[model samples]
Target: MAETLRIALAQINPHVGDIRGNAERIRRARAEAARLGADLLVTPEFSIGGYPPEDLVLKPSFNADAAAAIEALAAETADGGPGVVLGGPWVAEGKRHNGLFVLDGGKIIARRAKHELPNYGVFDEKRVFEPGPAPGPVAFRGFRLGLMICEDWWFPTVSETLAESGAEVLISINGSPFEVGKAQLRIDLAVPRVVETGLGFVFLGQVCGQDELVFEGASFVLNPDRSLAVQMPLFEEAITLTEWTRRDGRLVCTPQKLAPIPSAEEQVYRAMMLGLRDYVNKNRFPGVVLGLSGGIDSAISAAVAADALGPDRVRAVMMPSPYTSRESLEDAAACAELLGIRYETIGIGPAMEAFGAMLAPAFGNRAPDITEENIQSRARGLTLMALSNKFGDMVLTTGNKSEMSVGYATLYGDMCGGYSVLKDIYKTLVFRLCRWRNAHVPAGSLGPAGPVMPERVITKPPSAELKPDQTDQDTLPPYEVLDAILEGLVEGERGVEALVAEGHDRATVLRVWRMLDRAEYKRRQAPPGVKIGPRAFGRDRRYPITNGYTNLIA
Candidate 1:
């Protein structure tokens, strides 16, 4: 019987549906683990096919290919190297499962399926996978290693069952997505399991951007005494070997260096950078182009793109109209210069004039109102789309959550883009991130070290600049109030009376709620962006567009 074990945690990034590519990543990690003299190498959930394969796993061919990859990986373990714990889609007894397989000695030894299938918010695991029954520990090198997949460890029952079944150490493989404050939350959730079972715990999380989801990878270990033994870095790929020894009949993890947790601002910024970088590269877009309007939203959007994809791949265009202020033009050019990206000025005056002339006869003698303003916005959208078609750059939209929440944006205008970096970020947080980026460059940033935008851009009032003397405040309440109300309605899910009791005006709260409901259709068509908070639009928060339930006061 073995008294010691060395386990290597592989924090890797896997592309969804890229079975062979993912297999190669695992093999590479295993080779490193072998060099580190580890007994077993553990990877994240669905490391073979990527997590949330979302309906892609339903196809028979995909499952077959995944199975073939798993078999090939299993066969490679015959060389007396470290055993591998891999997760992927598996079909057994005419049922599909989120399966975790143990590969050693040129064969599959033990197989465990995920029991707790997450079905809320960003996860719909129950829609595609059949939950496995309560799992027991798998024997490895004389130690009974308790294994859980992702959500299984969230509840105490699964860990208790494994403990009752004579499990020694607990390990969980996860594809958990990142949200503000989630890294700490994982530790809070895992500490309880360790306390209940009195077993050391190892958590391995996937690190990569898959669609709108970005897994932060901050995988960690908790000793049997509920002390942190190791913490991997966030938002990057890493491989760390954790040593374990049986002390007093229980496995205990040796202490390792802990990576410092980043502040919330840095976490959100890195999430945006990683999310945009992967979306563009994985989708095979050559680059990104966005309108630099000298506003905080566009300015910060461009800054994030430049930092994420590098300045060379980001193109900034200044589209000026009759209402475009000279200060805006200068600020936009200054921002482009600071980021060192390709910059050009494109005047939309001609397009606006042409649209005006064409629609003049149809509205004979009707004084121009918002229709003229909308035409200007559509003209800019057309210009950006044209550039996108001419070159291969995807249009990056610059609308923040505040504007999108109140329907304050023009759909085909500023909302026109392939992706948004600020979609989940509220207006108030946008200002904070811009300041944060200026002061510190993130670890993997590709942009400049200094400020990415002019200081005035953050201080100046925000505007769409579609009409004369137009500020965002012209149509909406102050951002501080709007953002507070939105936090209550969107994130807190508070009722109107509750918000009013908290000192918000009753009428303003109801007005914001109405605007939020009315904007659902626009949000439905908006592009996917990095999800930084819990209630990001699209999958996280779903509301019926056509609803009759209004919170009316008597």
Candidate 2:
């Protein structure tokens, strides 16, 4: 039996539906692993077709292409280098499955399908993939590897069965998405399995943005004694070779240098940067253009854009209306200068006037209220859209979760954009992220190292600037109160009476709940944004547009 083995954990990013391209990425990683004298290369789940290909895997042509690509990669193993264990969609025994294949010596040596198909929140694997039977360890060169797909490692049955069946090591290939506090949760879940099975664990994951989802690749390894053997950095692609040896008749991994974990704020900021960067680059957008209002939402959004795509690719426009404050104009200019992004001022005064004159004939006796305010917002939206159309830059909307939750934004108005960076961030967290960005430029940031916004921009009361003397508090509750209530309503999914019991005003809680329900239509029309939290809108949290069941208790 071999006394020592070197396994390379490849943390890579794969584009969905790009079979040939993803196969090339795997080949590159395998080449690097061979150079490092590794015996085996383990990649993330669905590395051949990317994670959560949605309905794309259902097509027979795509599956055939993926199968062919996997076979081609397997043939490359004949070069007497490292073998590969990779994930892809497979159809066998008249059923479709999320399969993990072992490629060795120019052919597929073994195949294992995922037993657990995640169905909750952001995953619908059960709908597309049929669960395979409980898996056993796959025999490699003098080693038995307990292979688990992404969701299979979450439960105890698979690991327990593998250990009982004489598996020497546990390896889980994952395409898990990122959410706040998820890294620690991964460790928390992993340690228990190690304790139960008493085997070293290897977790390899992908790092990329797939539409509304962002996968932070913080792949890691746990020793048989439940100690961390290797820690890969988050939000970046890396390949680390872990050496294993038989100690006391069991496999044990040698300790490697651990990468420092970023602060929570930094993690979220990096996730935003990576998410925006991958979305723009992957979707082939030339660049991004967003309204750089002096408000915190737009300011932070612009900062993220500049950091993500570099200053030259990001464009900031100030579309000031009559209600826009002079302070806002100056602050926007200062922020644009700080970030070194392209800035231009296109006044929406003409558009507003034209719309008013055109609608004046139809409304003779009615006085102006929110209707006029909405027109101003729509005018600004129209201005931004025109710029996007002319320059082919994608519009980056700047609405936060608090505003989006209660319908504070207008649908074809302030919400006009191809994507949003702050859609999942609450108003309270928006202020915190701005302050954090001012203090530190994240590691791979392309923007300035210093502060990205003026101090007053963070301190000032937020406003849409649709009317004179308007603040967000004019229509909604204070952000402190509103965000707290929203966390209970949206994240916690608590009832109105439960919030009232927690010392929130009964009337205020009821009002927030009603508004949240009424705004479903608007949210359904909003642009896709980076998902930072567990219950992000769109894919994570799905609610019926027309619902009669209200969780209102007396």
- Clashing residue pairs, backbone N/CA/C < 3 A, model 2: none
Expressed as tens digits, the lDDT of each residue in 1-554 for candidate 2 is 89898999999999999999999999999999999999999999999999989999889999999999999999999988999999999999779999999999999999999999999999999889999988999999999999999999999999999999999999999999999878778988999999999998888889999888999988999999999989999998999999999987668999999998898899899999999999999999999999988889999999999999999999999999888999999999999999999999999899888988999999898999899998888888888898899999999999999999999999899999899989999999999999999999998899999999999999998888888999989899999999999999999998988899999998999999999999999999999999999899998889999999964863
Ten residues in a row with the worst lDDT in model 2? 545-554
TM-score of each: 0.99, 0.99
State the C-alpha lDDT per candidate.
0.93, 0.93
**On a 0 to 100 scale, what is the lDDT of residue 502 in model 1?**
92
lDDT of 1 by residue, 353-453 (tens): 88889988999999989888888888888999999999989999999999999898898998998999999999999999999998999988999999989
**Cα displacement (Å) at residue 1, model 2:** 1.5
The C-alpha RMSD in Å for every predicted model, in order, reads: 1.1, 0.9
